[model samples]
Target: MHSIATPKLTASMLALALLLAGCATSPDFGETLETRSEQASAIAGDYKKGEKLIEAGRKDVREGRKLARKGENRVNRGEDRIREGEAMMAAARAAYCRDTGYATPECR
Candidate 1:
């Protein structure tokens, strides 16, 4: 009985040793941690750059809106000026017809 138990104990000890050895030979945790740290830093840098770009885009949009409003105002003022000029021309044609008694093409 003693001889049989000795062999079983030795086999169990050998199996445990092999299992521990396999675990020890696996990938090094220190190297994996370092690689993950580098990847995280790169991601953080990209995120910061993206934030800056978004802010710049927002600024551009704001400036564009301001320019569009200015353009609209100019267009409105130009239209008003055109109406004033038309009224002035009409008045001049009426006066010319009254004074000369001549129905020129413009007076018509």
Candidate 2:
């Protein structure tokens, strides 16, 4: 009889200990998950904003490249014009030297 009573008391004590342990570690299912969800959404929004900024920066870079290429083309054209003008001047100097029969220093 005493042995049966001892086993029952032990079983009850074990059950009570497990119950308290479970209660101590129970999760808060509402506010904790809600707060975490909000945080996740905010992070996603920030990520999207960052992507937009990066796209804008890339567009600006492309525009800058186009402008630089245009400027380079203008410089090349200016150089070509200068070379053409120099050639014309040389031809005119040669003609003047031959027509006047006076060899000028520019003809050499």
Candidate 3:
């Protein structure tokens, strides 16, 4: 009985040893951690660059809107000036017709 138990114990010990050896052959945890750390840093850098680009794009949009508003204001002013000029021309034509005793080419 003692001999049989001894053999069984040795076999169990050998199996445990084999399992531990198999575990040791796996990839190193430190190296895997280092690789993951590098990937994270690269992702962070790209994220920062993307943020800067987005901010620049927002600034450009703001500037474009400002320029468009300025142009629209200029167009409005020009239209106003044209209306004023037309009013003046009409007044001048009327005055000329009255002063010329209706002999002006415009009155005729």
Winning model by lDDT? 3
Instruction: List, residue by residue over 1-108, the lDDT tens digit for candidate 3.
Output: 458545643333544544454455546645454454455455556666776898999999999999999999999999999999999999999999999999867899
TM-score of each predicted structure versus truth: 0.62, 0.51, 0.56
| Residues 1-108, model 1: lDDT tens digits | 458545643333544544454455646655454454455455555666776898999999999999999999999999999999999998998899888776677656
Higher TM-score: candidate 2 or 3?
A: 3
List, in order, the clash count of every candidate structure. Answer: 0, 0, 0
Worst 10-residue lDDT window for candidate 3 reads 8-17
Total residue pair clashes for candidate 1: 0
Cα lDDT of candidate 1 equals 0.69
Supply the TM-score for candidate 3.
Answer: 0.56
> What stretches of model 1 exceed 4 Å from their correct place?
1-31
Which pairs in model 3 have colliding backbones?
none
**Candidate 1 to truth, TM:** 0.62
Which pairs of residues collide in candidate 2? none
Mark the regions of model 3 whose C-alpha exceeds 4 Å error after superposition.
Answer: 1-42
lDDT comparing candidate 2 with the true structure: 0.69
Candidates 1 and 3 compared: the better one by lDDT is 3
- Cα-based lDDT for every prediction: 0.69, 0.69, 0.71
